[model samples]
Target: MTRGWPARLSSGEVTLRPLARSDRAAWREVRRRNADWLRPWDATVPPGSDARPSSFGGLVRRLHRLARQGTTFPFAIEVSGQFVGQLTVNNIVRGSAQFASMGYWIDQQHAGRGVVPRAVAMAIDHCFFTAGLHRVEICIRPENTNSLRVVEKLGLHEVGLAPRFLHIDGAWRDHRIYAVTVEECPGGMLARVAAPPETG
Candidate 1:
């Protein structure tokens, strides 16, 4: 069954919605402005030969195709009506291995402001509750302390490391894998946020 795209989710400070064609300009601007900061962490794509359409259009087309294939779900992170970043749950697998890998990036200006964690919590909730997935995995480069913190804050445990797990920024990079099962997250992410903190 084709799971319709999720409605916009909000956590008071950040909101997420399905990316639209109208967002191309703003998204491209955010990307260009954060190019240096994002390049080190983004997936590398081959250079295009023809210039008929801009790279942003090509990217939108690619995402639309993936959406139709049910292998990917992508969202634009918006803060106060501006596109600030992107989030994705890709490589969705069903049957015995009902899971997907999650990834995200934020505009440098929005970093360290709890934007990612809120957006991630929203995404994980959708994956487990709305999408009916058994588990979600987040793989991060060991050097990405910020990403590690985001997962840790969400209560996902480190499963293991995969050598040369992904081709990022042109080369194969090792990644530390972390995951949380639906059974382990019965109450969903919102529950974690509402639960009382533990005292030592």
Candidate 2:
């Protein structure tokens, strides 16, 4: 069985903590403000959907259950004293395969500010080093250029395409798969963060 891992992680300007009920107001505002920007790329929800409401309580319960089952880890992303987004490593498998799928979203206002990458790097380090996962995969809609750039910036390699991979905004959307194994992480994402920025 996968042992319990801590629910908090911090790196540079970001901190990832377990999602809490108190976060609802801030989270709701973030979602409300980013609604249009996020809609096309978001998972399908019913008409008149209120994700923050429908999913809030259920999310807490689900995270607790998944933590006990050793199959998922979810966190709220906080940067510079404000809740900005979420990051999750789901569908964890142990035994012969130590792997999980990565997913994340940032408030529209925080885009292009390096927050997601920092949070992602922290999460990747936790998964590979602390959680002992061998592989992590990120599936992104092919049209999400910004998200594609994130995975690429992290140095994950494109593995293949997943047809009808996910139901997004009411339809099954094609996604490009990218992966990075623990073995390939070398000095790890934390080290990569510390290294000098790549220059042209």
Candidate 3:
């Protein structure tokens, strides 16, 4: 494990920082308000699987422990010091396969103002330059147009589809895999995000 994580990253008003015990109120408030908006994309436990942490503290503790083990980076997404969402870099693998997958959600009120793309770029930059990982992938459900727009904005390559890849909203859902390697973003992904759009 490295010393700096769970790290704090920022670009303008968007920031990614470690989740903490004190974030219970703000986190719960945002999630509660956005439940209906987020339900379609949320992951659920299968019938036979063990129950996950019920309390906010337990969830934060578990993620912190995993961060110590070097397998995950759970972050609370904040815009100008106001908590708005979450972005997690999970399932990190080292050795021959230095890659990980990311998942995120944003408040409905802040959905399309470019907050997510900036956070994603920052996280990917950290994965490549700071964390020493080779590749980062984001798997999105086909119907998730907001998420699809994010990958499109960043120009990530769509590798393939994974049928029934993950259990989401209580059923097995297929996902489209989008990935970017360190080699592909040699100048860092944030730069791409900050660049002015190309006009046709």
Best by lDDT: 3
Error in Å for residue 77 of model 3: 0.5
lDDT of 1 by residue, 1-200 (tens): 35735456888768989887889889889988999998878876435534333467677778778877888888899998889999988898878887999999999899988788889888888888887888899999998898998887788899999998877887888999999888998878866755677889
Lowest lDDT 10-residue stretch of candidate 1: 45-54
lDDT of 3 by residue, 67-146 (tens): 99999999999999999999999999999999999999999999999999999999999998989899999999999999
Winner on TM-score between 1 and 2 is 2
Every candidate's lDDT: 0.84, 0.85, 0.95
Model 1 clashing residue pairs (backbone): none
Off by over 4 Å in 3: 1-4
What is candidate 2's lDDT per residue for 59-176, written digit by digit as tens?
A: 7777767877899887899987799998888899999999999899999888998888888888888899889899999999989999998887788899999999887989888999
Every candidate's CA RMSD: 2.8, 3.0, 0.9
TM-score to true structure, per model = 0.90, 0.91, 0.98
The order by descending lDDT is 3, 2, 1
Better of 1 and 3 by TM-score: 3
